[model samples]
Target: MSRRALRGVLGIALLLILWEGVARGFALPSYTLPSVSEILLSVWRQRQLLASAAWFTMAEALAGYAIGCVAGIGIAVLLSLLPPVRRGMMPAMMAINSVPVAAWSPLLLLWLGVGIASKIAAVALAVGFTVFLSALAGLDRVDRRTIGLMRSFGAGPLSILWRLRLPTALPLIASGMRVSTVRSLIVAIVTEMLGAYGGLGWIIYQAVVQIDFVSVWSAILVASALSLAFFGLIGAIERRVVFWR
Candidate 1:
């Protein structure tokens, strides 16, 4: 690893050490905050439980993320092709995004019930706006000079988009995708918290009600790990897709 990567690892290690020290030295009650070691123990002891919940949540998040990306990109492409409609649609998109997706969870749960569908919908809604705005910006942000040169070469709209615009916009879209990875997981969990038959969020809700703080922390740790893994996957794909950048 590079020095920067090493430093990040060291920083996380130090934080975990501090967290453990604070919880143990202060003699904090387990219900208040379990020590990092305790949380780890709980995680290991409850591996099956955590794994099942994490898998369920990951499936929902991935499904929703895929749907959101396709829909967002489709909208962006339509807007880009029909520039005149962009102006009219922009405000409406902004208006919808302004409302936090969590606020829609209750209604989603009521409509979709306490199954995976609600969580999936919540994740999709959370991720869609981000992908849409980023993709739209990417579609619109080509260098004027580069586009002029492409036009000078007699490159048509489709040719320019495939050969130039998309390449130029990939970095921005990748950034958006990276950001949405975490958001998708979070929204799914929060939605699950409201009402879910299974998932990490449901595990958390159960732990909370049972006053199993260690289990709670363990579930959170699992969720965090999943989010980090998802983010890293996106980063890797971004590196591959935008290799020049």
Candidate 2:
């Protein structure tokens, strides 16, 4: 592994060792905090169930992420191209974005019912604003001089967007997308915890009710893995798509 990767692995290892030592030294109860070994064992034993729940959660996260990215980028492009619409819509969008996803979850559950739709909507809502802000800022970062230069060469709004603004905005847009991967999964899981057919969040909820804290941790571990994988996937894609960076 590279130096950075090695350091990260070592840091995580040290943390796990410290965690194990504390749990063993204090003789902590499983309900309070199980040792690393216990959690790992629990994860292994319940891998099948955890895997199924993870798959369900990942599906919701991925679907919502795609929709959010598309909608966010599309809206940013639309507003960038139409200054009048941007002026009119910016305040409304900001007002909506100021609200937390948790605040919207209950209402979404009521409106969409306790299904995958609600989870997807919550994730999308959380992700859309993040991406929209980033993309809009990036799109606006181009110089007025550059835009005028393009216009002088017979470039219309669409042509300027396609040839100049979009390229200049790619880095910020990709950064936003990379950041939103984790948010998408988190929002989906949180919404699922509120109500869901099956997901890591649902598993965690059930485990909590049963006083199975180890299972809860196991589900959490699985969710963390899923989030990391999603984040890595986005990072990889961003690296490829934003090759200039």
The sequence of per-residue lDDT tens digits that candidate 2 reaches over residues 59-84 is: 99988998998999999999998899
Give me the runs in candidate 2 sitting further than 4 Å from their true place. Answer: none
Lowest lDDT 10-residue stretch of candidate 1: 164-173
Residue pairs with colliding backbones in model 1 are: none
Task: Assess candidate 1 and give its TM-score to the true structure.
Answer: 0.95
Model 1 lDDT tens row, 1-245: 97977997899899999999999999999988789999999999999989999999999999999989878878887788788899888988899899999899999999999998988888888788899889889988998899899899999888988898777778888898899999999999999889998999999999899988888899999999899899989998998988988
Q: List candidate 1 stretches off by more than 4 Å.
A: none
Residue-level lDDT for 52 in candidate 1: 92
Q: Please list the C-alpha lDDT of all candidates, in the order they appear.
A: 0.90, 0.92
Looking at model 2, which ten-residue stretch has the lowest summed lDDT? 224-233
CA lDDT of 6 in candidate 1?
91
